[model samples]
Target: MPATPSTILVVEDDDIVRMLIVDVLQELGFSVLEADGSARAIELLEDTNQRIDLLMTDVGLPGMDGRALAQKARELRQSLPILFASGYADTVEVEEGMAIIGKPFSIDQLRDKVKSMLGI
Candidate 1:
């Protein structure tokens, strides 16, 4: 039997960017959940029934920001994997267990990084 596709929660402030990412991820055979900002993302994260396998968030988000959101998420789901998408990827530093991907990444790069993180 085939394994179930991993579910990724994508938190991005840009509507078009988020849509493109969601489309690309869905096309690549992964289940995707999207949130425009930290508030909605937190609501989704708080939902116990949701099986979120990974969190891919933009680092330059408004209000709470991606790092803060990741910290809050960890409080709720300790083992959750976080992937920060940043425009300044080379300079971005993540926590020991977290990862980073540069902004304007190619479809292939995004796919590879996400799959590698999820081990899918």
Candidate 2:
């Protein structure tokens, strides 16, 4: 039997990048929820009906960067898995058990990283 699609929250300020990631997630059989910034992402989380299984956010954003957003999201959803993607290696540091995917990643890399994070 096939596995169920995981619900993912993608926080990205760039429209192109956000769309690309959303498309990729959809193609990989995951239900994607998008937000342009930290505020919107937080709002989505606060919605009573929504439940995000994972968070994939870009480290560099306009206002609240991925770190701050992840921190806030963690407060709300303590056990949610996070995958921080960044162009710069030093920009997004992985926490105790979290992981980081460097930007310009290929489809395979993204899939592998996500599967590993999700333990699929």
Candidate 3:
């Protein structure tokens, strides 16, 4: 049997960027959940019973930030992979089991990075 498509929770404050990311991930055949900020992302993480394969978040969130969100998310799901997207690459540190995708990424770049992270 074919493997199930992985579900990714995307946390980004920018509405247009978040929508674009959701569309891209969906087009690439991955399930996606979206949040406008860290609080909502954490709320979703705490509330959902569904399996979330990855957490993709922006580094510069309005509150709590992506690193903190990732930490909390790991507490909720220990093995969940994280992908950090940022415009300020110099300031963001990449953690273990985490990948970084720079902002202004093309569809192919995002698709490839996500696929590699998920090992699909």
lDDT of each: 0.94, 0.87, 0.89
Please give each candidate's TM-score.
Answer: 0.96, 0.92, 0.93
RMSD of each: 1.2, 1.5, 1.6
- Window of ten residues with lowest summed lDDT in model 1: 1-10
- What is the full ranking by lDDT, best candidate first? 1, 3, 2
TM-score of predicted model 2?
0.92
Scored against the true structure, residue 44 in model 3 reaches a CA lDDT of 84
Which is superior by lDDT, 2 or 3?
Answer: 3
> Top model by lDDT, which number?
1
**How high is the lDDT of residue 107 in model 1?**
98
Model 2 pairs in collision: none
lDDT of 2 by residue, 1-51 (tens): 136688889999999999998999899898899999999999998886897
Error (Å) of candidate 2 at residue 98 is 1.5
Q: Which is the winner by lDDT between candidate 1 and candidate 2?
A: 1
lDDT by residue for model 1 over 2-119, one digit each (tens)? 2788999999999999999999999999999999999999999999999999999999999999999999999999999999999999998889668999988999999999988877
